[model samples]
Target chain A: MKPGTGPLLRVAGVVPGLWLAGFFLLPLAFVWILSFGEKQGLVAVDIVWTADNYLRALDPLYLGILAKSLWIAALTTVICLATGLPVALGIVFAPPRWRPLLLLLVILPFWTNLLIRTYALIAVLRTRGHVNATLGWASELFGLPFEPLSLLYTNTAVVAGLVYVHLPFMVLPLYATLHRLDRSLVEAAADLGAGHLRVCITIILPLAVPGIVSGSLLVFVPALGSYLTPDLLGGPDSQMIANVIERQFKSANDWPFGSALSFLLMYVTFGALALRSLSVRRPAAR
Target chain B: MTEAVRVGGICKRFGAVTALAEVSLRIEAGEFFALLGPSGCGKSTLLRIMAGLEHPDQGSVFIDGIDVGRTPANRRPVNMVFQSYALFPHMSVRSNVAYGLRVTGTGRAEAHERAEAALGLVRLTGYGERMPHQLSGGESQRVALARALVKRPRVLLLDEPLSALDARLRDEMRLELVTLQKTVGITFIIVTHDQEEALSMADRVAVMETGRIRQVAPPAELYEAPADRFVATFIGQVNLFPATIGADGTAQAHPFPGVTARARGIGAGRQVWIAVRPEKITMAPRGGVPAGRLSGVVEEVVYRGDLSVYLVRCMAGPDGLVRVSRANAARTADRLPGPGTEVVLDWAEDCAVVLAS
Candidate 1:
């Protein structure tokens, strides 16, 4: 509305507009176009517009893998929420001088490469890892028979690795929400004859809905598309959707099918986002 | 009267800062008591200790003649209306008010009915279904009061309940709060820094400073007499000058060689404060025997609607200024004394109190 500011605002928006168009929109369009094409020959895709690739993605074997990936991602999201909520609360209620240190510890994992962290998980969960060795020592101390339990190359390892890598995503959002909360509301509840558990259930949890939703989505979306963690820590039976997509592009030489699977994952992400928006609207409508 | 809340020697420390230092207080049953002080004077800390929200490092809190020092806030028979009101934004007004009853396992129908009755008490009968965001500041304050009162607490604690309202609404709520307290017939303990609010609503006010109680008295007594200089200046406007007492019950100041005022204390050569309210001093045209009067030039005249204040520059007074206020009781031609007018300020023999310096 200011003089000559319309053109000036348009000029300022050009930088991010160009970057998003070039990096995100172009790649997404390419994959979308590839999804409707067919594999004509080895190492090439034909531009014959058809739904064959989409149909092949909906087959029983691929559907089974998608369902398994959803179960794993859902389990990972639940675990992250349960663990991250308490951690965020602890950081929020800690002494003012110690808050920065606790937040730094939560975020320090980001400085390390994900591949290295996943590899570290591999080192920790393998047959002769720290946990099994500790259990062996405890059994010896108790004078009982000792057997090293198999902790590596299972679906459990994949879930464990996913929780570890994605925990900070959950904690950061929950912390941001709970920190901005008016603590006096909790005090008022306690003053009105509500004890600790009642306050947590009636006041804290209901107020933390937005944080819980966003944290779950952040963990679930990335966890569904996880590749390196499952590759390093999961067994053959624990193949997720991302691993299947990789095999379609690499081992099977089928770019069209891989693009179709990628678009399917994008649809799931959109669905989750729609749920979040619906929840936000529900409170506003009230 | 029977005691409702008695906190004895309550002590609390936040890290290195001593927030409360052996504070003690007593509130009679069904009496409206106010802990009045400036911010960070340990009034709110003492209130929290009595509410069981903060544990005292050392002390005992007895409510209704029973020791409740170890009880938690939720277990105590007291509830607080927070300064921010602390209304649950996610709940409707009815749900918020009914929360206390429902939490203690009361039936939903009965809780709803009692909540409605409490809302009616605050004259918010139809606003139960509305969320907290839909209410105004004054409305939210009433809802908070209703929510706390619905539980029928033995004592209600209000932490600056009207501090968030506009000036007009604050005045309105002050009278309403007193009426509601009397109607309920429960002990009420209020914490506030506003002297006018405390003096107007509370039956007894405890003035605090620097983690200690300065004095506790009724409004009239606190205004007419103060225990020390802190209480003297904190409550209302006063003219203060240091003076030494003589054996003849007359106080003498050093600036003017022969000026004297009567003081009832029995000590001689003791340094004390000569405290007189601004309204107690009378200013007239400078032409009298200068025995007990100090002559000065009028520095400024502040014209309020109901009263006028005269600031006189007197060499014989501490800080070189003496303040006198005259009420505008009737229309008069000479009420406006412009600056630079010469005036004589004098008070009656017993108008001032000699307090320990």
Candidate 2:
């Protein structure tokens, strides 16, 4: 960390740098090279440069899936923001002794495997699952007729599963920002004749925009490219773009098209992040 | 003068710590008052209570003769400038100043005009476009003041307003605050532990200690005739000598057996302290005429630009050390006493205030 330690610093970076070059960057370079190639047969792809696969991705059928994926991801991000905000605030304002426990609960889900977590969602949302079974028991107790609701294997289920997994991503950053926020500013707002709602809308939200930006990106990107949740919990009509990419590599046997699709999703994510940096860096007064 | 704010029998406790204990004060309108004390002495807590940010456990706060004990801070007719100048960091200085007006539903044009006027009052007219983070510490402080003053409340509370500023800036702001108070003619209640800040600006000061108001008096009275040993020492540097009162309305001073000083309103034969400010004592050479019977060698001399403090160690004993401060007159620039110089210390009968030991 001291000055004139440049050689040591460069040496420290060599291990991770080589790791990335070998495992991550090289594989990504291979994918980029493969994306320009033409599919020869069931197994191999010719090294001929072609834009045909990217052109194929522009088809209306795949476009519709991509659009649906964006909508679902956007909706999931919005819901996460709404729900995670209150939870984060609650944790921040809780007694100091209780805060660690509350934060642990938020992070506890990450310890378990994501695939197993998605399966756990299946038990709660499937037909004759816990929610409907509880409702049906209540109906029987009340002597009212009822039918099991089709809750799982739908777009609604996919959104719910996404929100379930991504809520912590939203809450953690929000919690960090809210925790560092000066409580005196809120008190100052109240002292200056601001009511509770006005203080929140005028003072709290604007200050929290940075956290919301990062949290939304954290939830939206993963939700857009989500594979396990939609694959397991979504119905036949709920095929997201990730599902299409998976089909291209597996049954479709078109590695070039899959690589192109993956890169396309990456481009959208990067574009959103770039746009955010531009707006966040703007120095103009609002 | 009309009463601006009054808190009656206020009592507050935070867990085991008693922040305020049956404290009460009546502040007059258009008067600048101060609550002065050390940190954690409940001055800021009492200010917050008056601002309606805090509620007392067993008391009522009256504003303009109406008991608004239960009113929230937002509903109260008072504003506070915080110690840290808690301006909204996300807002521009203009919006920060106009926040109270805008939030309370003032028209946009009117709010903007009044906010600009407030900014002008603080002498920060063209700095409104800068964000809170963009401004310097003193600028942020003025923005906070402008923010609160724009609301035009009947009472303005400042909690340690100048503590964050450097020495020269604090002196400048003390004068500005006094001038601003007279311009607006609203009651200004400032809380500070700096004796100079409280004494210089406040029309009257309530000196607090350990959650209790020890004395409430004008600046001159608090400085010249302190109510107790604590105020005497806290207001400025003072030399306290333990003594017993004589039957002739004079205190029998210690160590120097021949010295006795007259003090008013104390029973005879009681232990007391003769409290004299360092500036009050005059220094003379050893064996000089009109000097006290006692004499000591100058132990140390601290040279301040305007004045010099001399610590004289009397020949009587260790308990006989007396401190004297003299103004550095131009005539004696070459002859100022240095260390190890033999000298005599003397004070007038009126210089000492007698307090119970």
Candidate 3:
């Protein structure tokens, strides 16, 4: 190392390392340790051995919640990809002067609090809200048979909210990756006698796989852990594992089971991520 | 003889800037041509117009006598090796070369076979399994060539294909490219700003300036008889002296204490510029050719490996100076002109070009 890279470097790096250890790592470690213990009253049991919590959490009720959570997460990822690819491509194709402005708009929703954004969905989905009011006006003007629509407290509403909130996370990285792609690659494909559609499928799409994978991870993982959107916009049938975990921690006061559920969720998340990296790793290696 | 490509009065404008204006050129079959210019001279833009990647606002692009004004780039029978090579980073070299064939609905085995053969054409056999990033810069450039060649286009456009390589690599690749063109027997249009690369490799060079081609000639002809002041300066280094034409078809350029050249043909009272190559100007001891003599002091001497350059302060104008380069063979330690040493500069009248503008 260089001579002056001593005191200033340690102050800049070591301080952040200490803070992460004290704050993020410590809480996660406590939760992990708590997951291995049994619940007596409001605290864990004295014994440090247990597989029962994990096996019980895999019971029908919690498993059903897991299925619902995975399904919602998968759907949100699909919707984000379907919508975000075009937005990302548009940003990449925009003029250099306009690109930053367009990106700022893509990320604008994140500036508002997540809770406020989710609640804004509720306000819009209400019976007399903007959507229903527009439909009612269209019906009155066209003389079609129509009434006020019901969209609130539905699975569709929950997915719409999830997509709205997580879209920037998917789009920003996709835009960055696509922007780095050489325009000459597309021209080369075309010069090789590939039509526009062929160029997109054979060259552009395959080259952008990294971006798609990253965007999917950004959208899917967070949607799996989401509770507020579903709680506010979804009916009882659509509640995910997070809602169950929230209930165990808050309503039931079952800290041990809640801790176990949290660890199980983390295991599933890491397992899915590990599988994704493994699958994509081989093609990249070649 | 077939005209492989024809560009007719093409003009392109990007907002307010004119990139190409009324540009026209015909590339014959099996010929190698080069567009030589500096950056922002619109050589690339003209090449793009011919390749159908860009459309000219005022004219048409024809390939093999086919009007391809509205035809898309894929429909044109041409391929381009981009300046950066533009190899697909995610795909293996084989897959990248095979991409053109696969997109055209060629069978899988045949595409692979042709791709291999194309790779072999560039002397990159057995490099199919490696990704673009794994290969060296020259290897990637070869793969890009293979990818374009696999499609078997009638015309090949090379956009400064050797510019990315180091000096030694560039020299090696220049010969390789010339040989490759001969082996392929296809029409090749290359764009370059390197004067040596253009002169050494191209059969014919089109010198461009300000969105226009100033002259198109063989490299030797262009170097010997440049059309204008810009061409004279752009093609090679030259010393220019402002002069005036006389009524009796005589021109005068005085770069000495009291001497001038009685140049011919140009009318009187017109301003002209006389250009002479540095090698054309010869230096000698204080008084050799009294008729063409110019007394000057040696300002600086730059002794290059093969030649020595002398910057002389002449007496025609107070601050006028001219440069002359001599071969390193005749070495005289005693008469070596240093700073403040008096000398005479002289050149044959036939060696200079007088231009009236």
Candidate 4:
């Protein structure tokens, strides 16, 4: 026992610890317990233990939706990294005076409500919206025949919305890591006869792995569980597992089945994350 | 013998500050040259220009008598060991050393073999598998050196290569660097601010000040006959006196009793500065002042291990203290003058250097 740390540390840990125990852990424990129960009636569950909910949750229909959700999440993560890495690099290498302003712009999307931002994206992506209208105007001006392009209510729109909403999550961590990168290391690489692309491939990307992993995890986890974007922008075929979970809890009135589905989704997310961490760690440990 | 590098009237300006102003020098092949100066004196800028990392606004650079003024750093036949060493933290020492070769499209096996050989040259043979973060500072520094040397460039530029090490490690590395330079026998240009490091390692040193080269000469010539006052003081401790030359070519200063030194190439009655090294001046117990000798009271005595320095306030010449250092040959403290003890200071007339103001 260190002298000063005894009481103060315990006091500091009390509020957050109690909050996690009350709000987070308690509900998670309740959900786990409910997953084993049987649905008795609408919005009601019997306390009798059963494996029926797990078996139902594993049906091929639900499994297909889970696979679709995984694919969409993976695609969103790839798009975010490809786009966010360049913007992060630009911000990190900008002049010191412009760095704070650029970083503020990167995070400025967070200041607005995410739902409102998604609706705004709808205004741009809809069939009769800004993008199609602009293309119509350009076609008319060029005297070429054209039809309105249907972009909304598609899986592409859902992925686009997810990328737009989660991009900052990718950029911020990458920026934080790139900001501390030693400039002399880049200069040394050039001095040792490495071209610009070679330097990025050999030095910059390898050093930024931690940032990449963290950013990917942040995007992938939230994209997997995203409900609003798929519901608002996706068509019937583009509906993800989150939409099914929402239906189970809301209209279907299957609380035990919903709990089982949610827990299953949580397990899949954890497994994906564990696999990613293992892959990222093995190369670094070498 | 063709010179390895020839820089001609190079000038660079960054915004409002002129970093290098028409700096020109030539480095011979297989020579170990040093650019010695204080911070912001353009020594590092000159080294970067030679490495093709910096562009000169006004002049040209020639490597191996070929004009390479417009070449990019990656295409130049030169490399630099940065002051920070800048070892890639994520890569093993082998990969870090082999990166340059790999970038040039060498086979992986050959690159690794060459990297291992270069590491052996730095006496870090078994350190190839260790990551940069796992090594000590000295080990990382050696890895950086090996990485740069593996390219076998025509010239090597080191920017304050030893400023990061502790005193003991720095001394040991200094000796190793000298031996390495001799074995490799390439044109090595090292930038340093430490006068002792420059003096001990460089075959020729160019002293710079305020973006201009003050003097460039061999270490012995630079120490014994500095071209200007900055070189005289920047290289070592010295006492400078404002003196006037007589019609008979004799120089007289206020601090000395009579004629102190001979002035050459100066008109009669013109004022000049005379510099005398502290070690050249001899201190003796007070007596009647002799001709051309100055007498004063010892103001302070700083006793280093192998030498003792006496600061004497001159009563006969200038209104300033003249410093004199004596080798500590015996354990007789009583024989050396203490504070308030009267002392006489004298130096050979030929030992004083006449300089422009």
C-alpha lDDT values of all predictions: 0.91, 0.90, 0.86, 0.90
Q: Chain B TM-score of all predictions, in order?
A: 0.96, 0.96, 0.92, 0.96
DockQ score of each predicted structure, in the order shown: 0.87, 0.78, 0.75, 0.73
Give a tens-digit lDDT track for model 2, residues A1-286.
7886998889999999999999999999999888888988998998788888778888898888888999999999999999999899899879999999999999999999999999999999888799899999999999999999999999999999999999999999999999999999989999999998888898888888888888998999999999989999999999899999999999999999999888888888888789788777874534
Better of 1 and 2 by TM-score: 1
Best-to-worst order by TM-score is: 1, 2, 4, 3
Tell how far residue B131 is off in model 2, in angstroms.
3.1
- Report clash pairs, candidate 3: B246-B268, B251-B263, B256-B316
lDDT of 2: 0.90
TM-score of chain B of 1: 0.96
How many residue pairs of model 2 clash at the backbone? 0
Give the best candidate by DockQ: 1
- State the lDDT of candidate 3 residue by residue for B197-233, as single tens digits: 9999999999998788888999988887788888888
Question: In model 4, where do residues sit more than 4 Å from their true spots?
Answer: A1-9, A137-144, A276-285, B247-249, B267-271, B288-292, B316-319, B331-334
Off by over 4 Å in 2: A1-6, A137-144, A284-286, B246-250, B258-270, B291-293, B315-318
Residue A103 displacement (Å), model 2: 1.4
Pitting candidate 2 against candidate 4, the one with the higher lDDT is 4
The iRMS of model 1 comes to 0.6
lDDT per residue (tens digit) for residues A1-286 in model 1: 9899999999999999999999999999999999998898897788788999889989999999999999999999999999999999999989989999999999999999999998888888888998888899999999999988888999999999999999999999999999989999989999998998899899999999999999999999999999988998999999899999999889998999999999998898788889989998999887
Give lDDT tens digits, candidate 3, residues A129-183.
8899888899999999887878998889999999999999899879878888899
Per-candidate TM-scores read 0.95, 0.95, 0.91, 0.93
Cα lDDT of model 4 by residue, A189-228, tens digit: 8988889888888889988888999999999999999999
